[model samples]
Target: MSSAVSNQARPAEAGPARQPVPGPASTGTGTSGAGASGPGPGGRGPATDYSGYPLVGSKHPWRWVGTAAVALGVAAVAWSLATNPRWEWGVVAQWFTAQSVVNGLLETLKLTAISGILGFVLGFILALMRLSASPLLVSVSWTFSWIFRSTPLLVQMLLWYNLGYLYEKISLGIPFTDVRFFEVQTTTLISQFAAAVLGLTLNQAAYSAEIIRGGILSVDQGQLEAAAALGIPAWRRSTRIVLPQAMRAILPTAFNEIIGLVKGTSIVYVLAYSELFYTVQVIYNRTQQVLPLLLVATLWYVVITSVLSVFQYYIERHYSKGAVRTLPLTPLQKARKFFATHAVAPSRARSPR
Candidate 1:
């Protein structure tokens, strides 16, 4: 009787703790009362878990929208290609192999190679002069650069075409004296091709000077300071430490300018030079296959440009030492890499146990 009375007294004493848990008949929020939690008072409140809730986090709605837009654009282009009635694959194939077009391509390659080399050489010299400390050198370089840069390239080419009129003869003499040692008529001294080369090269030099200056400036000043601290000669510092790095930075832009120069060379048609464009103009004027000949010029440009692009890639890779962490692949190289990867992937997949 004593033990039973003790157990009954214990239950009454613990009633406050038991009140915290919701009874089977209760219907309420997880809290049992104003201050009590749901599971027995301190025995972990009704396990108020959020793990059962749906998971949500940051999502890129714009990325999905962009993907959809790209897909739609591709589909539209495909539809246009599929439905176009004027598409003539056969004619295009025939025109692509025409002899005139083939000859034009060869001529374009020659012209581009020659002009690019000459322009780069001349431009490099101008760039050095422009950066010289002497005010006289700077002024001379500035004046030359400004004259060429300010004047339209087309105007320059035309002026070269008619340069003979400006000077009947160039006399080698002392300044402010007619004491001529040797003289030659301008026409005898310079051919049309030579004149075109001079005009194009000078114009290209001006632009290249600016490009080179930007590259030189892009190199960190700390490099020059460090070279000086090491007691390196100024010329050695510039040639070895500075210029090599600057060239790497400027090569891509320089390559682009070279490509532009290649196209610009077509403007020499004004002088009736038998370059690729002149060839096309002559063919079209005679044959009147305007669109086809124009296509011929376009094809020639594409082939020559494509070849130069590959050359540019190799040149860029050569210069990109120490600075570039990883060199990027050319389009052809990337395609080759992809195919090589795919070829090995299947073998790797099959060899596994």
Candidate 2:
């Protein structure tokens, strides 16, 4: 220790500082070896080697801060929801699976299914008509969309329900002929259910026709022309080449319309048709539990939309093939990755220093 102090005190006595020390490569370790700090050919000192040191990760304090802020906000909202008495969550639970409510839910689902299927079918035809070269077909398709889209859905429902006033009877027969296949009073034909279906179907069709047409139009014309050059049948080109690609564009919007139709089904209450919303109205009217009943309907709608959203995500993912290099991870895969990363990070932090 006295000698080291003397060396520091008399630095001028030492000659010019030696060049940077050689690394482990220059100093042999196996045969007649010199250690990491041992001298090289010219007796050079060992240079520092960073490779032996433990790695340190970057820090992002703001990231943690933002995460904490969002977590606190979410927790506050959840707390409020749990503590609030006016939400009447118990009442929501009570009527949520109630027989009448369930029955009404079934009716809503039934209406949505029947109307959605028929609406898309009719819309497909209308889309074809709109896309066709014939002027009459185009005119008719455009007129149908315009008429339905221009008027309020409520008016349409009301008008359809009261059809008996304008048309005494609805008949299926050869036009300009006496021969009739079927005939019935308009009131008998357009019952509550029938009117509701008709209104929903026509309104849905009007929107869906545009959606399908837009999707079809989005497909490149160059591909269709090239397909024809290969002598593929027109029908085959449309179905195999065109429809598949068009579906990628169509499915998202189509599902949106279907979800909209689910909510729109509530509008049938105007006809006094007992769908979920109408049933909720009836219950609340009798019990004077308006907010709770509305909450029930809102929660049911949330559940339905949530389910539909999951379907939309997967369907969109399926069609995304070839469009993206790698498919996005599923919810389960993301959860696994998150846990794996954070779990390892904590274990590493707690490791022996």
Candidate 3:
């Protein structure tokens, strides 16, 4: 009787016509059909659900614009080369690979290196002057810095070249009187090369002084206080704690300035110094092929600059040791890993959860 009652409560089995069937509508398609096409009881089936706007990830109008700009630049370069008459590779190669050009390049490099070292040394003293408590010392340094920085490098070079015209001789004399102890002949005291070196060094010192000053100022005030609290001498504190940190801060800028000075030595050609540019001018004047000679100078500059760039990188890495991370991989290793990961990823079915 209980089994019959249960069967009666369950209701008679429905025929196919009365039974509901799962359809595409039940899967959120929202289409109406009897079989899989019909919506289920949930009423949320896939339908002509074009009621919402289409999804696009973020749009970048500027990216398209930049791409167009780069395309135009490349086109312009190609057009210019085709139209211009300056594309003689033979002359360029000959002059570029000349022995004279090589010598000039070496000389240019040496001058830049020597002048830069001397300038940095002098600049250190000037930086100290600017930081000194003594008003006189500070004023003197400020004046020197202003004069050199205010003047153009070309003007300074010219002035040094013609220094003999201003003074017959500069004598070591007592102040306010012509009580001369020793005299330096103006002509002998300043040669073209000497003047070039002097001008470059002095101008560089002014700029480098500011670089150093900025570095020193970047040191934390609390660090200085701590050093004082520890009873460290003022000089010792500066040299030991402050200067080392300042050097690290200033190294990158100093390296850039050094590179600039290397290129800037070309300006010495105005004085007829037989530096790289002047030598190139002499050769090209004789050869009468200006473009080729210029190209030679440029190539030499590029080569020397490349070498110096490596040195600068090493120096920067040395100073940046504690500040920045060294990469885990060498460039080649990193590139290899990158390609391998992308090209040989594990198959999805083989991948572990």
- Highest TM-score: give the candidate number: 2
lDDT of each prediction vs. the true structure? 0.73, 0.86, 0.78
Candidate 2 residue-wise lDDT, 94-141, digit = tens = 999999999999999999999999999899899999999999999999
- What candidate 1 gets wrong by more than 4 Å, as runs, is 1-103, 179-181, 328-353
Better model by TM-score: candidate 2 vs candidate 3 = 2
Off by over 4 Å in 2: 1-70, 335-353
- Candidate 2, residue 243: how far the Cα is off, in Å: 1.2
Models ranked on lDDT: 2, 3, 1
lDDT score of residue 147 within candidate 1: 97
TM, every model: 0.71, 0.78, 0.71
Off by over 4 Å in 3: 1-85, 173-181, 325-353
Screening candidate 2 with a backbone cut-off below 3 angstroms (N, C-alpha, C), the clashing residue pairs are none
Residues 115-194 of candidate 1 have per-residue lDDT tens digits of 66777777777778888898988888889899999999889887876677898887798979778899898877767677
lDDT of 3 by residue, 181-296 (tens): 99998889899878988999999999899899989999998989999999999999999889888988788889889889988999998888887888999998997888878877
